[model samples]
Target: MDKKKRVIFLVDMESFYASVEIASNPELVGKPVVVCGDPEKRHGITLAANPLAKKAGVKTAMPLWEVKSVCPQAQFVRPHMGKYIEASLQITEILYEFTDQVEPFSIDEQFMDVTASQSLFGSPQHMAKMIQKRIWDEVGVRARVGIGENKIQAKMACDRFAKKNLEGIFELNSTNYMKKTASLAVDELFGVGSRMKRNLYKIGIYTIGDLAKRPLEEMKKRWGVNGHILWLSAHGIDYSPVKNDSTELQKGVGNSITLPRDYIYKEDIQVVLLELADEVCRRVRALHKRGRTISLSFRGADFNHPTGFHRQTTIPFATSDTIEVYQASLQLLEHFWDRQPVRSIGLSLDQLEDDREIQLDLFSHPIKKLQLGKTMDEIRERYGKTAIFRASSLLSSGLLFDRATKIGGHEA
Candidate 1:
């Protein structure tokens, strides 16, 4: 007996942030709506735009000024990341009603393996419609679904066809995916970006059909493992399973912030670094992990000709202490930074291990610091993150207070 084909669905929310705003506020339903970051904070890119806004030439990641120039009548809404996250959780619950094999691809997209669910829900097309209707009726957001024999086909089907289909459903299987997409530009493939497209063109492969016909060994020879992966993708092949591990271990904890303005002074930069270290260490401690390596990265204010440096240092002992991480990051900045005006800064704690054991240090009092961090975490968890904060957070150059009110660098 031949094995049954896999039935995968890639469900993507349409104009997620903008749709959430329109759903929450009925008055904005018919308007061309665009959701964007706060312009005052220098994060004024369009996060999402409704279909009407798209018709008016608004696109995601476009500068707010350009959006205004194209569509002056567009209604702009600031992002509410917290609400979007809540809605995402609600949608996940809805997906669980059909199958447990749901893997979130992003804030607005998910992959669901429903091969075993056909007996309960009906055919793949029927199941897709059911999922779309349930999400719309329950969460007040429209969803498009792409059906396929695997995750890659489903994703490509949704991005390339379903989103544009009137019914908002498309199926691209192993039988017809090539027939449908082979003649398209190589850049139209799932993972081919501009650079990859250029490289493929250098090899006389301009279309997906050209790539599919190329020998797999030739691809591997040119791009190594990534080349092999690209060759497989060109043939509509992917072996990755849909995973839904809620307790997945994080390899690192890091935070980066785009400063509202360029900071040329070392004192101001140090202040920002201290806050970043504190934030990252807090997250690391929350995960019950300690890290031995600290990485520091910064970008110069010049946008046309970007200049920056990223450096890492491994300490003798793993630690989740904010001061220790800050000190290490400070050393990197002082040693590597060319004293240029910096527009963004980031820090990360890597080479992580479970924080079940502590290495005693006579001079550092590691145990006391851990205890203090735990106490602070407890206080913040109970009252609020702002309930307990360092004195440096109140400094003129500090952004902890502003950042505390936000999630993912946008308003919460």
Candidate 2:
């Protein structure tokens, strides 16, 4: 028997944060609106903007003042993370009603394996409309959905092609994938980033068609396994599953931030490291997992390597305590620091295992610190993360509260 062609839908919320704002206040509909961080404190970066503002060249991450200059009539609003998260949950629930294989790619995007639902629901194209209509009817947020035979094609189609179409839905398969994507720039592919694009350009591979024609073995030899993956992605050959289980999907729990400004002092760097470690460990614990390896990464203000230098160290036992992870990360940072003005930092917990048991130390255990961390987690979960923050959060360079209100480094 031939393998069943998978039907995947990459459902992305259209201008999600702004849409939610419009949904809440119908008067804002069809108007140019921009969601951003605090504008007064110089942290006001454009997080999302409606199509009206986008048409006027209002781009995300541009300074709010510049956005105002571009579209003076645009209405700027602060992000309400709680509202967006609630809407996201509602969207997820609606997707679940259609299929059990809905995998949330981000707060505003989901990959749904609807192959099994074609018989019960109509065709994949029909299902996309149904899903979009339901989300708009129920949550009042518009969604752009792309349908394809696999995840990669679905994502690329949604991001590149579907978003440009008026219907907000598109379908691509083996037959038309090449014609649709071949001549596009290599950077437009799902997995291709700026560095990869530059490297590909150096090798005379500036287009998807160029990448598709490269010999896989030579590409792999040149860019290692990642190169081969990129080459395959260019040809729309992804076979990765849409993982629904949170535990199965996460290889690590991590977070990184490009600071609002560069940190020139070691104290400021330490503050950010501790805050990042706290977040990573809290997430690891929330998932009921612990990791033996803790990694720290940072980059200088120089934008040469946006990905940055990352280093990890393995401890004797698995743990999710923020202090332990922070201490481990501190060692990595100390060893790896090149003394350039640090601009960003990241922390991660890998080598994961179920946090089911803890082995007692031969001589002593840091029971007090473990208990304190657990207490803080409970307080934060109940009252809000900002309710009980560390003293370091008081530092001018700290971004604990700012980060708490954002998702993926933008207004949530």
Please report the candidate that would top lDDT against the real structure: 1
RMSD of 1: 3.3
Q: Candidate 2: how large is its RMSD?
A: 3.7
lDDT of each: 0.90, 0.86
Model 2, range 1-412, lDDT digits (tens) per residue? 1258899999999899999999999788778999987765545778889899899999998888799899999998888878888999999999999999989888899999988888899988889999999999999988999888999999988998889999999998988999999999999998788988888999899899999998999889998999889889989999999989857667788888778777878888899988988888888887878889988888777665554587889999888888889899889878988767876677889988877676576543645555677788899889988988889999887899877766555555
Off by over 4 Å in 1: 1-4, 246-254, 284-299, 302-336, 347-375
Alpha-carbon deviation at 60 in model 2, angstroms: 0.9
Q: Give a tens-digit lDDT track for model 1, residues 1-412.
A: 1257888899999989999999999999899999998888877889899999999999888989999999999998998999999999999999999999988888899899998998899999999999999999989999999998888899989999999989999999999999988998999999899999999999899999999999999999999999999899899999877778532436788888889998998888889998888888888898888999999999988867889999999999999999999999989997999988998898999988888888878999988998899899899879887898878778888998888888767789
- Span of 10 residues, lowest total lDDT, candidate 2: 361-370
TM-score for candidate 2: 0.85
State every prediction's TM-score relative to the real structure.
Answer: 0.86, 0.85
Q: What is the TM-score of candidate 1?
A: 0.86
Residue-level lDDT for 319 in candidate 2: 86
Clashes of each: 0, 0
Query: Runs in model 2 with CA error above 4 Å?
Result: 1-3, 256-264, 292-318, 332-346, 350-353, 356-372, 383-412
